[model samples]
Target chain A: MGLETSKDPFLTRVKQSEKDTFMQKSVAKAQDAQWDKREAARKELGHWQDWRNLGEQIRQHVIKYLPDYLEEFADNVEKRGGHVYFAKKDTDAVNYITNLAKEKHVQRVVKSKSMVTTEIDLDKALLKIPGMNLMETDLAEFILQEDDWDEPTHIVFPTLHKNRDQIREVFQKLGYEGDNDPTHMARFAREYLRRDFLQADMGITGCNFAIADSGLINLVTNEGNADLTMAIPKTQVVVMGMERLVPSLKEAEVLDNMLSRSAVGQKLTSYCSFSGEQVAGESDGPEDLHVVILDNGRSNALGTPFESVLQCIRCGACLNVCPIYRHIGGHGYGSIYPGPIGAVLSPVLDGYEKFGDLPFASSLCGACTETCPVKIPLHRLLIKHREVMMDKLKTDKAFNKAIMKGIGMGTGDPALFQMAMEFDHSATLPFVSKKPTSVENLYNHEGHITHAPSMAKGWTDVRDAPRPPKHTENFRRWYKDHEAQKGETTDGE
Target chain B: MKVVVFSTCVVDLFFPNVGAAMVEVLERFGCETAMPKKQICCGQPTFNSGYVADSQKTMRNEVDALLSVDADYIVGPSGSCVNMLHEFRMHLADDPEYGPKAEQLASKSYEFTQFLYRVLHVIDAGAELDAKATFHRSCHMTRLLGERVAPFVLLDHVKGLQMIPLPHIENCCGFGGLFSVKEPEISKLMVNEKVDDVVSTGADILIGADQTCLMNIGGRFSRRNLPIKVMHIAEVLNSNVDMSRVRYANEEELAAMAGGRD
Candidate 1:
């Protein structure tokens, strides 16, 4: 389950998520709350569009010269007594990291939240090693770990789907009896995580952005668990998506300002730490630093129309604004990555065979594009994915293609369109409601179309579609008659 | 001004009153309006569904029809359709024949309210509607066309109409053309949420710039027997008219309106 989080079909997952009213309510509440925070944060910074322009330029410049910067980053890291490994795929990343764990004879591993590691299925791979103990120190990730590794519904707030009661139940499994108060649960998790921090020999954390000029891993978290994870463990591994790097601290600082603001509406996360291989002068830092840059099919988007998708800072702002995500939740996407960004990225990383439906999940609302801090054009990329799948991949159904072909023919020729307009009322009248309804004024004929046959049943099932007026009363004919009357009035004048 | 009306297919068939209201409103502004009979759909049904090659034919037919008339401006009742014309430049940029024509079409085209407020310099349409209403800002119009200010300002000037600020006005109404049918379950959930927001407003009428959105949101309101009437912004502006109060932006007001999106 590298990228794929659930084996359930997309609709099945949607059906399951639909039953979780709590998740839906929570997602809505979180989105509305975050909307104010994010807007206020941007407003505080002033000239948000200009800042977004700067953020986009920095990401675009780095993406344009990605390979050169990666090499520079690797060289600088090596010079600082750090080992660098570029994993082309998830398996490669997992194998390299697991091998390093074996080489170090690691027994206890304390981890911080890293989506890249989850993307590569690193946790399960590490768990396979005999007597290896891994604990997720991030508050949300720890809650998910305790709940039998429930998949994350959101990027920033991983356990957002879980309520205080569910979290209390998860914490009770670790042998503590307490009320469902959030503070009590957090303290319980903190105490439990601190014990692991003292005993842990290795720490794994995700890099928010890797500074290339001066090789350093930047980690931003509201909780200071990442600092503790790096500080307590002798050996540390910093895993990152290959695109998560800037040319220098200057650019990283710009993005850090944006990421914190966009991600959680913070001026800066509680802990914005930059670290590398332990220096001789430093008393407390990792002695052995392993940097793993995982491509994991990110290169598939390179040189494609979708290359801009790599501009994502994983802010999950797209999800917060997405109507579809609000309804179906993250599991409905059936990928480790979800929402608008996931819709574009999952198919790129996984291919159309498994993730084809994700792109069409959106209404192409453009909210994601407007909200994106780095301006990924998430909605446009989703359309691009659809185009690739239907046109190039030829994965769409023949029936849909035939229907679309009919639409093309009907809309393309005015003669055909006129013929359809002539028959519109007569054609749909059969499905029009026989008895007048409360909203009878909405339809001039019997009533609104309460029921329809064929493909239109989808529309009729949920709502009453207005029946088209007769050809005699249609707009074109009406406009013609009105124009004639206007000519007469002008002549009289 | 001679304005060519792009009476979108939805308005031509399902909601012709919206087209009539738009034409009437334009006439009231003292502009000669012409509807290109050859114009039909904007090909969004197929284009957004990913039938790019097939949709191109429909798009080309639209560009040809909209350009058939010699007019100073081309305007439509639907911002969504207007945005489609704007995107014609992107879709047909490779075509040697229609590319320039598509660009020309985009340059002249405007959404109905946008044309009234921005192009014609309208500050008030002098229409009265004795009803409380909330506006649903359709996604394509507000976000894609970037015409957020026009509808609100024009609506604000509608005499005797008390407007309520809709909750989550930024959200889509789940009428993404083919998306409503292709993924109806998700669409249902989204529209249900939209209906709830409108219902919560306690407004008797729902007004939106795009008929497609009004069709979806109003259709659901009818289906639920909610008794909430829906009116397109064009119809709202073309309501009971008081020509004496009709006003246009003066030079100072024009400068203030300059900051609005193109």
Candidate 2:
């Protein structure tokens, strides 16, 4: 998956998705199930707001002192006989992991669900080394792997947009002989993955939260894949975003609760494994352990307005709640992280030249922020991204120039604003299908007329652009005219 | 009680009757209502479109217009506008004076039903209208303002009115202001869903607090030529207009009604 998906006109994708009634129905049903489960879980948790507040506090505290905690975490990991490598960028991360794989002469690697791995394109990176084989151990991820390395639509579900039939087709393509039933498919995949898990030379997993004090990497999974991936493999490698660190086990517990509830509406996942450095006399664990803490532009966010974005736990709750994500689905985001978090993070990690349009994808409804477990202020970050895109980077130069002119004119002169309004009101006449108030007129105008010069193509390409009323008779003007006709003085303080 | 009216740009322009109705309703509740003369737009259109600087201009204009008023409360019939006032105050963070002014403006502003129920403590205005109506809970109001209870409280008490609750009332009617025009197909899909919910209610009329939303739903109602009358809740409550004998028709009736010019 590439950032070009977001560059595709939103209208085209929306129309395509709308046409896919089957996919739409599946999405709607899944959304309903997830929403109900989430509601019930919130109610069961009792004082869900308190939980959210605690989650936010823990994340905030962690982000606030990330550097210190990271150092402490590294120290603890070293003390426990684990090696820690801090990578400032994707190259650094890939090089570190590849070196480890080469040093161990790792022939086969089994991986659990790790978005960070995808972010760095680690699988592709690792495949460059001769005689290296990477296998996805998660059932959904394995399906993705089997399906010619299809990008995940959602961070948590991975293949959520794919129906059971689609999964069956993928399984069939992979030469699986099993009942098309979901349970059977799952069981078949499980039996297949269990063998790979047992024989894998290395286990690579994403850390949900790395506890600073004890040097523990917390991994939450509904499938016992992570446990198996770590258990049987001779060498283990954990890759985590640097921000995925907590001060202690107490914070880890809070985050674990938040992550489970937010991701899949569970009190806790089936497997909540906390692994530290390789210990002596440990029988069922990897002999060598390497923790790669990848910065990957996250360090740039610290002390910025978007610092809160670092607080995201990759729970994918924001994706589940986003209206845009629900409609176009996550593949449209063209990133490992999709939906609201992806919209904010993609442009920051990647340059806006590629993902500038991502920020504009949202309606800024604040739903993501409202539902966010760590209170990342997802919408605010979207806005901040726009600000930076427009003012600082000037990624969309033509659009920004036009908007700046609009800003100047809109703010500089009330007369100019009124004039523009007047022009707009009158301009509606040509495109007006029935009357000014008619939906047909609005839709027609929206589709036909290009209102704002730059980026009008971006908007008008998708939907009817409603013309703003150009009448100078604003509320104030109307009120003045009415009072003048009545010869009555206005009452005010 | 002194109440400042933030006649949202939509009501002030296309649907002036809604504003007139708001004035009458508030007056009946003993509110000394005053429309601030300098207020223009709520800045939401610019703000939501990622034109923060342009939105701030509009916001600054709005703040300048309303800050002088010392009303007990500022009330608007538009949930979107009220929500913008309350929620977008943070955008003014860079401007110290205007930032606090925006917050102060937000604090005084309430969606009409919220002001009526919370501020005026008037559940039933003791006024009556005869119509079977379903309420469309504007998403911004319900989710952003958290004013879910106020509209129900006020509507429950309207004498001679049969209130049928709309199914999926929380779903947006897709009048996301410029969103309807910008993303017409998706907007149509959303509004179509809303219309289905409205039609399923089997009510003769669809009532909402925001004129922009009502206009969007109303336009769809008209386009489809559904026999559903879309009216602002303010118009429904304040009208005292008996609809028992009114026979609804297609283009002819609408033309006649427009010609009658009441």
Candidate 3:
């Protein structure tokens, strides 16, 4: 499920998500709760604008010299006796991780929360190995794992759609005698997953920031499962999106502070660890560490106008502010990278034709841009995707193309524009007359269209469309009357 | 000062009265207003939807028509449209002809309150309205155009008006031009939430600089028969004119519209 969670058409998937009232409520509640906290946290972390500018500068520097950084990072990893694999595609990344697991003959794999692993469909690839057993160490992931590998709905809180009762139900399957409470469920999960952690032969984690100077990978989490995952296993594999790197721990530290504030409104998560290969005398750490940097279409964005998308820190701040995401929820996007970041990043990775509707899913309200810790101009990038799909790819439907073409011609000529305005009301008169001319009743005689045509039924379903007022009822007519009465209108200067 | 008005296509056709109020408000500030008849749409509907090549044609026509006016400032009642005027430069950056004109015109183009507060330095337009009202901050106006301080400053000086802060006022009303129709379910949820936020403030009149937002949020308000009046910022500023509330949908009229029909 590498960002391709839904094969259904975009509208169909949107409809499915819209019908999920529980998910919608959950998203809205989470957003409201996080809004004030995020605001306060950013205010507390003084000079938020300066901090954002610094964060943006750091990311821009890393991305501007990404090739050099990658080379330096790989070399540093090699110096630490760790292997670095640059995977140009999802399959390339997946094969490398699974092949490594196979080489070790690792039977039990315990994982921390890693979206890049999900992007490469790593769990499926690893599970394909014969007799391999895997468990998600995070509590949310464990609940989803118990519920039959349910695809995560959010980047941070994957099991946001599940309630306390649902968690208890999933927990009961593993012989837990606890009430339907979060603390109770977490305690039971810890007891249950501890055995897997101790027995696990392989550990897989997603890198939040790959510090190039030190060859260390940073993992930030509220659950602390990541710390356990990195320390427990003899063999460990770190999956990272190629752009997730900083020059050193200094840059990583600034980002970690910002990420905590933007992600969950904390000063920091319960665990923010910078782990590298095991020291020679270390007692418990992976002797063999493999870091796989995945391109998976991210390289497609590196040199384009979309290069800013790689600056995203996966803080989920955009999702918290997204009004559209509040209604349709994360699953509405039908991608592993949900909400604003998903809209921008998905089309770049999955091509415009495959994910054309993803860009159009936004209201372009710019909330994501405002709340973004790294200031990724998420809405502008969404518009860029639309332009790429329509103007460059010429992938928009012919009907829409024709209408837009007509708009171009009509607006370009003042004569045609005035003519259209004069006749627009009459042209729409039949629809708005409400005389039961047709059973459809697209419009009411009150001059308001109650229902839009099928292509635009979404508008009419929620609100009424005003009939274009004829003659003096329009603004031009009102302006004419007001100006005539004033007798003071000027021509140019 | 000479002022050229960009009465957006939405106001020109559906809400023409707004254009009247805008002119009146501008005149009160000792500004002469010019209406460039060659104007039509701002090319936003097409540009936003990604028809860059076609939208550029409309944009070039607009940039040329707007440049024909000899005015000190170009103002529109809408921040979204005015911001698009600024964006015209970006759209035509590759074009040798319109690119420079786009920037020249965009530099002078301002949203109504933005023009009033920033250029004219007039906070109160010497008009009064007796009602509790809350202003909806259009996403483009506040976040895009960076016109936050102006609207609040002007709304402050309105006589006999109580300005109550809307809860989560920064949230969008879900009127993304085509987005209202393209993603209707999400659009409805957002507007309804906005309506709830508005009603919770106990304000009878909802004012905003952008009517695109007012249309979506107001349409839902009218449909729900919430008795909340929606007015463009221009109308609120032209308080002496005694204009009626912009009716999006008359519930009684829509209900009785089918009356006595077979």
Candidate 4:
């Protein structure tokens, strides 16, 4: 249930999510709520596109000089007396941290929510260690943990599919008694996690941005749980995707501003901090700091057309505007990254065979690209992914390819297409009906095709397709008559 | 000036009145207009579906057809298809010949309102429309084609038309051509919400520049038996007929609607 959720195929996943009315309603409502707030937050900075350009420029620079930045960032981290482990594979990352925990005789482990952790299945890996207790401190993460690890539905708001009552039910099983009010649930969860924070032997957190010049990691949260995750533990491990590096604090701050605004439409999250290993005099920071930089197929995207996916700040702005995501929810994508970014990034990470279908899920409405703060041409990338799947990676699409080729041949020739158009009416007219009638076991009824065969059934299943016109000759005739009448009348005038 | 009008497939077959209106409007604006019989679909059906190599045929054919005509401007009633035509250069970037031809066509091609306002600089075509309308800014037109202001500029000078902002008007109408069929559930929900916004505006007519979207929204409207009339802005602009009455969707009423801006 990590990257590949169901393995039930793409359309099946879409069907399952479509049937979840509650999930559909919640996502729609969330998208509607996020619209104005994102706009207002973006508007707070005058000439927001300038900020986007700056953001894009900064990310583009970092990704282009990634190795250099990584060298400088790792050097600075070690200079600050921190350990840097550049993990080329997820297994390397998992083994390094699990081995460290074993070496320290770690008993109780706590973690702040991290998508990278989910990507590498670090939780599952850690749980493999016997005689160790682990907990997810982020409230949503904790709830999911308690529910036996229900997958996250969004990047920023992970438990988007869960309602307050469902949460109350999850918490009630942990010896809680309260109404479905969020405040009460937060208070109870705070007390519950506060006790664990005290006993937490090792704290692991996700890095939102890693400032390369200073070797510092930045984390943003509303509950300040990440601050606690860093402060309370003697041993802290920060897991970050390799692409999360910013050249310096100036660029980091710029992206931080954009990320906050784009992620949750906030001026700033309640807690935004830059932390490194324990400073010489610092009493509260982690005595032993480990920064695990996980490549995990990111370098695969480095020189490709998908290089801009590395530009993603994980703002999830694309998700809020995506129409398909609204109906199918995050689970439909079957990847930790969902929406426009996921459609582009997942195939880049996992290859096109499994994740190729994700790209086609989008309508290519350009909404995602328009709202992107970093100015990623998300819609175009989606198309590019489709191109790679169709032309390069995929071998089983010959039928679809043949069909498209045939269409191309038809449309490329005006005479052929016009002839096809002429005969299409009689071909389709057999299936069309004037109204839903008693004597019908067929494709159409009531001036619409209610049911259709083959791939066309996809549409008819949801909405009725309009019938083709009975006569096509009248338009050309009308054009001729109109031209003649206009010629005659204007000549007289 | 001579104008070659590309009546998009939706216009050529389904809604000829809209095409007729566009030609009449351009003609009345003192431009001689003609529709070439050789033109066909924009190949978006294949191109957008990730068949760019195959869709190239339609793209090449389109470039050939439009380039065959010698006109001051090549205009079309569809923002989406015109945007597609403008995209031919990018698609045919490898062609030594068609690449330059694509650039030339894209430069000369414009959506109808775009040519009217940007090139002709004619905001008012001396046409009067007596209807209260809320414009659905189709995604391709406003966002992709960057013709956000031209349609509104033209609508502003109509003799007797009242316009109000649609709530979250930038949201898409779920009519991504093939998307309507490929992901019908989401498409249905999206268009339904778009219709809700149109209904919320309380405008009698829902006007847009693209017929694909108009048809999608209008189809849903008719299916639901909603009382709103869907129209192309070209038809509205082409009308010089005297109005017996004008419909209204006032600022106060707009504000009264749920989710309205102050």
Candidate 5:
């Protein structure tokens, strides 16, 4: 339940995901539905690019002075009668929160949807205490919790992989006799979470943006559960990735708009709360507040080429547009973060040794970059990751590196390239199918290679590759002949 | 205009017809075009796969070969390769010798449709094809080259061609050079989805600006035994041409289309 959701090889996970037609269909449906809504929401803003530029500038500025903002934020939280803890490691965060829970003698704890919490494996850590009962308040998180703590396939729609019938079956475990109607099931979940909300002695929520100037913790949610998590408990703890800090409430307000539109295609989330220490006379708010600012490999990206990755607001807009994510879903990444963001970030946060292949998972399509509200250049970052892996880290396999080198040497010399072009047709002749398939060999003059060996097998396995044109009939030769004919006519005229 | 044709490796070897069609189309527009023979590849095959050091030599070779012709503009049939040329300036930014050359090549380079509309000011290539066609917008063209309008505008001008909007045109065809080979499983699934969308458009022919996408999508169509003819945008623009029907953009319209370029 940490950064890695699976220990299986990437290709193995991809193979398993490819077989998940149901999950694939669900993800595609969600993406298609979100596309219209997200586009419409963006277009309604008018000058969306300017807005994006502003959002990007704000994020970049904050990231540039992250430490200063974090210092100001921690100071403000302290001034507001709140305890601030900066945990450099994920374990530091888990240990601190768990120890705090034990010291307070808390028996029940409830949580709202927070990717950082999932990232640090906090739920697993806290549940280890004896007699501890924890409830996930978000409906999707609750569904996952009820389903034996299944990993989220998406950052926003965690349970997107699960169908309504699956949700119904999962809910049936909690003694709900209702059918698979989403609203009814949601109602049943709300009622179930309401019981825990009243009794929960401790509540944990993730920060949307930590407003440094006011020391307010910004929480955005479609559901009001985060409010409940903050409102109902006597002890409150907020977990945030260190990069989630903004300069002020104004910036937070701007990002809140961008996040909601990009994440769920809404103008604003249903509940956008900026809360901190309970007032002296307040009756309902938490008396004790704890804020855990977690670095946990985030600093690995700071001052590096990957620094822009922290600019992400966890909108998951990249996932909705990524063709790779479309086919394989989240688990295919093997990291808690998936899609283009994950492809770039996982290697930085978790090192190339563990998450190197995530970069190659993308088709370098640039959809993620195009769709990013913050304009993170997700696809370019993916390529950067690959460059780092191959040139600096030397994490890629030797065979792959050798092939790339061979390609480089081959392409660098025109003679070698011409030779490759000339030889390709005859070399592939043995593999080319003699009997034509559906269409005549109109385009493929030398026939298509339906099957091949080594690297090309991957291509020929799925589709026939046209053999390079015969050397005598290649484009350059043909062009030279055509130009000669044109020259004859011009000279005669 | 004197233009140099940078026939990408894909077109030079595998799909020469695309390169040929591009030449014919350019000639039809009255632009003098010449092929720089040494411009063999764009280095995307190695560069995008993370072979930065290894690809530098290939990239340098390309910049040298492309700039050797000394033409008014350099153009390519494939947007993906053209975008790679655009990337060369940044990639070679540190190289004091070739940095300026790379930038010059990038500035002059354009994809076929972009060159036709933006540079040549021609909207109609006087092409006609009596069939339904859907265009698979290559990812590099739309996103990297920032050319979403050029291909569509030119396709709209192709007389007798019924253009249907391809469903989910924003998605990639999954031919990320080596990515196609490295992750064929995922690539297969993605390309299959593309094929489904192409079929959904109910078009007999699928056209695209990049041959790489066409090859991947067309390969899938053929592998699945779907008889959808795959074509480059140039081929569609070169088909059944009538010289008298060709049209060009007015000065104001051209200025607007080029974002105020005079």
Candidate 6:
């Protein structure tokens, strides 16, 4: 589906999400459960903040020296008899991976969950090569693969928005004969994926954090599908975002702990598999291991205001706590990523022209900032995006101009400020009604209206436009008259 | 002590009696109140919307107006604006010229109940009110200003008032200035939830520190023909206004005494 086909603009999605009672109930229940579990998990772990601070410091150090880290990471992997490829862009990344599949003449590719691959649309790219059957091993990704053109709702749990009934429908459509029970569903998916794992020529997975010191790529998952994919296949390719690395295994251990707690409130996931090149003594592992470090616009963020965005461990903790995402869900964001981190990262990675509206979608309530384990300052970064969009990029001309004018009038002179205040209530009175039209005029042809205007049509498509107050008694004037009548002295200071 | 009342634009236009009640309540606590004529807005509408530059102009004007008054403290019926005043001081931190002015504004300004409890140290004002009431904790006051206990402290003292607990009291009433109109459906949903909470309390009146929330919730009540009354915290505290002489009930009482009551 085209991005703009929704027609209801960005704010409308928020309104729609707000009114989604089903989604709200699900989100509220999930949040309560997750928060309780998270609290307990944090208390259990002890000194979570200190650990988070260390994780943040490590990530920051890595990002600051990203060039050096990337080189060190690739060198270490190569030294361990693993092939390494650096893809500067999406096309380059796809080209390198596709050429590898072509050279291998791979018939079937079993894939684990990898957002970097999704970012490059690598599955679609792989399909272009003849007879390349790409099967998603992750349960959520598998459901998305079966559903026609459906995107993931969340990074961690891509199918979190979908309930069991929806999953049952997807399974039924995919010709699965099983009960809708979660255990039965898992059994059916497992039985079905086990066959594909056996037949697959190459396995592709995402690296959570490539440890430079150990020359090993770590994959964390609950299902152990990544391990199965890597072990059963003849060749394995790990496509990772360049920033996803730790200098040593010690830092990886710290990060894995933080990631588990923040992502899904787990003490640890079911599997944390580390594999590089298969050793001679190893009984089960991919013989040819190729680690693809994809740097698609991430290099640009280094030393920039958005450097903290790279520290994200894909925990989805920020998304879980986001009020805006709670309502709009993920699909509304029109990207592979969604929620608070997506609101910042999408615009940076995808450019402001396509996703600039994402930053303004938030109320800047700072919930994301408070909940962020790595302390990314998600809300402040969003504001910084707005500043860049309005001042530096000047993407939306009319909106920026209006905002600038509004700011100017508000901050200019005391007399102007007083006069505007005196007139504001009266000026907006025409549209002040219990039932007004979707759009209404504030003044004759001046365009200061009650309804959402053309550029702001996104906001009004789903919300009731507020009717400004229909009275002219500015508080200052009322106070003056009341004080004068009370025989109070006018100028005390 | 001389107290300057920042009556807030919402109360001055849409709900004037909130200002009147504030004055009355302040006098009962033995404080003289004044309203500066040059005051406009705390510039939250622009500031929260990412128009910090524009909001700064209004902030400077507000600082100048409040500074002109030689009052002991600046008290406002709206916690949102007072919170904005505190937020604005931090925003002006880099400027050496406005740094002291921002500090002065921050030190002097207080939300009404906060001023009553913290500044006046009035544990009980010895007022009498006979009705069941539930307090709606405004998000700005609870989360931003951290003034959760002050309102309850004063409300607990009302002679005959039965205070009921409102469910989900900490949730935003969905009256975020631009947020209400900008996303009305969700805004309505949030407010509806708040209304449900108030109705569940079985209280005769719903009280809040901010007029913006009261206006949104109160308007919904009026539109839906809900019987529960909505009042600012100041109006609840200044509940000495006798309703016995008025034959009108249900908004008619309010309309009859509208301009003259204050």
Question: Residue-wise lDDT of candidate 3 within A162-225, one digit each (tens)?
Answer: 7899889988999988898788889999999999999999999999999999999899988889
Report the Cα lDDT for residue B12, model 4: 59
Q: Is candidate 1 or candidate 3 better by lDDT?
A: 1
Q: Which candidate is the best by DockQ?
A: 5
**TM, every model:** 0.98, 0.87, 0.92, 0.91, 0.98, 0.83
- lDDT tens string, model 4, B143-202? 788777778867887888999789868678888877787777667877888888888998
Write one digit per residue (lDDT tens) for candidate 5, span A1-493: 9999999999899999999999999999999999999999988877888999999999999999998999999999999899999999999999999999999999999999999999999999899899999999999999999999999999999998999999999999999998889999999999999999999999999999999998988999988999999998999999999999999988998999999999999999899998988987776678899999999999999998889999999999999998899989999999999988988888888888789889989888888988898999888888898898888878777887777778899999999988898888888878888556554323568477789887888998888888777888889888999999999999999
lDDT of model 2 at position A482: 61
| lDDT string, candidate 5, B37-133, tens digits | 8877899988888888888889999999999987999889988899989988899998999999988988899988998888888888899999898
DockQ metric for all predictions: 0.74, 0.17, 0.35, 0.35, 0.75, 0.17
Q: So what's the TM-score on candidate 4?
A: 0.91
Question: Model 1 over residues B34-131: C-alpha lDDT tens digits?
Answer: 98899998889888888787788799889989999999999999989999999999989999998999889999999999999999999899999998
Off by over 4 Å in 6: A1-25, A43-55, A280-283, A395-412, A420-474, A481-493, B1-4, B23-35, B70-72, B115-135, B144-171, B183-204, B220-227, B240-262
User: Relative to the unseen true structure, what is the C-alpha lDDT of residue A73 in candidate 1, on a scale of 0 to 100?
Assistant: 97
- Residue clash pairs of candidate 2: A421-A470, A446-A464, A446-A465, A463-B184, A464-B181
Model 2, C-alpha of A492: deviation from truth (Å): 22
Clashing pairs in 6: A17-A327, A407-B54, A411-B57
**Candidate structures ordered by TM-score, highest first:** 1, 5, 3, 4, 2, 6
| Candidate 4 per-residue lDDT over residues A285-355, each given as its tens digit | 89889999999999999898889999999999999998878878999998989888998998888887779
True contacts kept of 5: 0.80
- Kindly report which residue pairs in candidate 5 clash with one another: none
